[model samples]
Target chain A: MPTAKKSYSTGAFWFVAPAMIVLLVVGIIPLLFALWTSFQQFILPKVHFKGAFAGIWPIFDAPFVWLSNYRDLLFDESFRDALGRSFLFLIINLPIQVILGLIIALLLHRPGHEWLKNVTRIALVIPMATTFAVVGLIGRLLFNGDFGINNYFWNLFFGHKMEWLADPNLAFVSISIMDCWQWTPFCALVLFSSLTMVPIEIEEAAKLETDRWWHILRKVQLPFLLPGITAILILRTADILKMFDVVFIMTRGGPGAATELISIYIQRIGFRSFEQGMASAQAIVLLIITIILSRLYIRFIYREV
Target chain B: MIRLIRRLALSATCLALTAGIAGAWTLEEAAKPYKGTQISVIFLDRPGYRAIMKMLPDFEKRTGIKVNYEIVPYESTLEKEVRDFSSNGDLTVALVDLVWIGTFADSDYIVSIDDLKKQFPNIFDPNYELSDFFPLLLNAFGTWNGTVYGPPFDNYSGLLFYNKKMLKDAGFDKPPDTWDDLLKVFAPKLTQNGKFAYALQSRRGETQSCDSFMRFIWPWGGSLLDAKFKSNLLSQQSQEGLNFRQQLIKYMPPGIVDFDHIEAVNALAQGQVAMITEWSAFYSTLADPKSSKIVDDLGVAPEPKGPAGRKPALGGFSLAVAKQANDNQKAASWLFIQWATSKDTAKEYVENGGVSGRQSTYKDPELVKKYPFIEPMVESWQQGVPEFRPRFAEWPQLSEIVAEVGTNMMIGSTSIKQGSEEIGKRVEDVLSKAGYYDGKKKLAQ
Candidate 1:
């Protein structure tokens, strides 16, 4: 029994040893170093390296600072307005992705629906595979303020022109539309895959109880897909939190910081200003907020199931 | 067989390593004049680099000293230069922007030319004909605290670029001479088919902070720093300057505030704008047959006057030897700098369309005839002052505040007075953190 215990400990050590080393070197050491540095103010190219043992004191020292960076962000009213606009995007995109995915999954899973289903699945998944950067750039070109194809169509439709990214309200909507076009198919595929995992027995029982399609979906299919929907929301919120590359390369938080997000603000402080210490503090705050929101999500929604 | 294959691979690896080390040794031997020496030069990878590359063969041939050059984009080079100086490394021979000389000089990044003259006269070269250089080019970016820091390269003082054809069509024979004249004569001509009258780079970044904002600031008789490196952006003159830029946007293309250097240049090249206040280097691109729509019909002049007369923003590069460099590499680097900025060399460069800061280059009758923009540039340079690119270690932070607030002002999102005051407050805060200011007074004393 002693020999077996020894062997089991050795086996576990070997399995976790690489990851432990990586975590120590890449994660813990840097986190500790950043934590030590964030308390002291920074000027580019020089810091006295006078690191005192400042625990969570820096956070408490300026309770208003969180509001300051946020206030600096609020100076641009366009971005403030975009928060509401983003809701419009979420409203349109969420349902479209879910419905399209569910319908496709239903048709494809119907036993005999093979060729048509496979073709549709391949076609739908292709957009998901395309790089988001390329998609956003193409979107910019297609919806260019002056010469884009969309502008031409818009002129034909309304007998007038629209500066897609120039207008504050439209700029947010443009990015949202691009995000939806690129990511809706991805959500659909994930939801569709989850739909297949739904037990056939449950669906058959529900159908017999109600001949109505809507009733079957409301009772059987959607309830089965609840976990998938939650996963998508969690995944998307996390992804959106760090949305930098596309927005950076495209708008550059421009037309007067209209599309500037938290990530953009963080990048400006960290890289452009060379205030790494403050950037680390900002990052820590953003992380805490993300964690709290995630916890709330799990508490309110996931625990109910 | 597996053992034999492993042995073969090992032998090959050893051979490659030996070859690599041998190549490195040869390179080191060639740099014997600067052995045990490392010099770091931070510069922009643009026209400034082109001149450096052109003269590298000559430099290596003469000095036998290897040059360690790091070329970054123009926007980030200032921060990188500061980092190179602040770090423990012997960062010798940095190519800094003209505006940055003050910032670098204040922090003791590079040895002052005054110090060099006293201690290292061989490097100073009083006979180097510093007087021959354009006084504006020499004084505007190079001089700090009454001492020169580095020689100028590829001068890019702002010039008024106009469409001669457009001006003629607008019933104007000459380009506008002042801000008021620009609005009165050119704005109407420039606005056609839903296009702006003038194109200016107002996008947030270095361009907004250094070029566009400074262009307005200087002409409006405003400055960024006071005598003691304090913020002066909230001055009455500065407020007026900020407002002038915002008002100009009214007559500009839709989204003028969003236009970066490339976009502004493109607008002028495509004949979308009648005039553009831009760098002199832009003339080369505008005249290029492949890029410009109206090549022959283009004209250049001194930047239009504002309240203070023609005060075009200065933009160029300066070569400063790193303080941490060893005596030998410093000497070798100084030798290269001397040769590069020599009257003969600068004139040769000017003849090749490389704008030289040396006044002697402008006096070269053939050179002036060949490049007509040179003389007017010299005149503009003579009218030039350093503005606020004086010795101030906190200039970089001040630049960011200016770019951010100036951009807001241009878009009409914020009032000029409000934006200027905000910039002043932010700058004062930064300077106070640096111990350069104390809100109501300078802290240096």
Candidate 2:
């Protein structure tokens, strides 16, 4: 019995070794390097070393300005504005994605619509299949005040065209609409898979107790789908925090920094301004926020039946 | 025996003559040692890059050096080049924008022309004639802190491109001669029924900073910085310019604050707007029948003067060798730059939809007649402001602040005075952080 237990442990070590090494190389190493960079003044252009080690040794030699970058970022109005904008984006997008996704999942899970279910599932994947940057370009064209299709429809309803991309509030709404359009499908798919696990006998019992759809959903289905909802919330929270390519391609945080998210702000600091230390510090802060939010989700929302 | 000796002597003399002619350092000969070296650069989708692509085959055929390029948009070019340089990536040639010269030069990301020449003495063609380029373009686009880093490749001077039919319909025979004339005379008459008189490319980013915001202040004799590199934005002259821009906004399209160069130019091309001040490189687009609605009615003229005088915007890119490139790649890249910007190739480049910086290219009567924008472009270039946008390493950070506040000012979220003050304070803070005030770094030239 002792020999059998030892053999099982040895077999598990071999199975985990490759994944652990990969995580160490690609993930852990870069995160550690970024953490080290946050504590140093490592502006790329300022590094004066030359030759083969030019890219390396100077980075190590960069002046250690402990907490200076973090202090500066705390006082930076642009960074604060970006952080607030990202949170606002999350607040606006999270509820719509969650509720709408669950509704679509429930419809797909309804009995006696097998053919319809396949077609609807296939159609839903189209939005999720489109690349983020291409989605941004499409959004740009769709929101253009001069000749976009949205303006055409809007003019038919109203007497004049609307400045969708020009107005700050409208532009923010447009970005949200685009995000929901692209990501809601993914949320729907995840929730639908979770719904497939709902036991028929329990749903039948809940339906016998109350014929009302809301009552049955609240009592039986929702409790079963809490895990999926929690997952969606945590994933979307992290995604919205780091969202960049679409916003960059669409408005470029324009019309007076109306849509500048934290990622865009950090990109401007690190790549445009070459202030690597500040960017790294901002990244570390964002990482901590993400970790805390995910913990909150798992702790509070993932209830065991 | 005598006849054979005479024939052999004649053949020897002929061979010697051919070798002597080939010894004059042609680009093809200079590229001999680095025949198979592959160099890479970032290019834009603009006319200038297209023109170069059209001429690239000839270059590759003459010299065995293969040139690879990635087409990047203007907004991404700076970041792409900077990232490539920092990482010592595959880019062997740097396509530098005018504002990036100081940044690139200060960071030592690019090798200076003098250093390249010193390193590769035999690579330059005798007929290159560097002085043939316009003095203004040479200094403004290629030089930083009196150091010649690159040679001007894609050069431009802002010119007013107006629709002649629109002007005539409004009872004017010609474009406006001054900013006041444009605002008071042409704007009121031409702007009506959803059509605007003019459109400024004010979309946030460098377009807003260089094309829209600085375009206003320069002609009013307001500089971004004083003699001591301090903020000059809150001065009376600068405020006047900023206010004038605000007043001019009413004469533009409803959402003019979001119009980029493509949209603004399209407005003119599609007859939505009567006039737009744009770079000379866009002439081909406006001239092409497929892209323009008023090609036959298009008229080109110098940008209208302000209270001070004509101070057209100067913007373009230069070709420099990357510091990360090996010696062979550097030599081959230098040869390509020299050949691409040589005096002999200027006419061909211009004919292929490029705006050449060579003074002689504009002087050609044939080219002037073919490309109507040439005369006005030359006029602007001759009198343009070299520092239309401040040429300094800190300008990128400063430009961001200006773009945001400038856009806010246009949209009425901030008054001209408030916006200028905000920009002034931000600019000072950035400059201070860079140690300019403490004399640790050199002041902008």
Worst 10 residues of 2 chain A by lDDT: A49-58
> On a 0 to 1 TM-score scale, where does candidate 2 land against the true structure?
0.95
TM-score of each: 0.80, 0.95
The TM-score each candidate achieves on chain A is 0.76, 0.93
lDDT of 1 at B375: 64
For candidate 2, write residues B195-281 as lDDT tens digits. Answer: 999999998889899999999998898888898888898888888888899999899997777788889999999999999999988
Off by over 4 Å in 2: A1-14, A48-60, B1-23
lDDT of 1 by residue, A68-185 (tens): 4444444644334444333344556556655666676666666876788788778987777877678767876876655689989999999987866655556666776777676667
State candidate 2's DockQ.
Answer: 0.59
DockQ, per-model, please? Answer: 0.22, 0.59
The alpha-carbon deviation from the true structure for residue B207 of candidate 1, after best TM-score superposition, in angstroms, is 3.1
Largest DockQ belongs to which candidate? Answer: 2
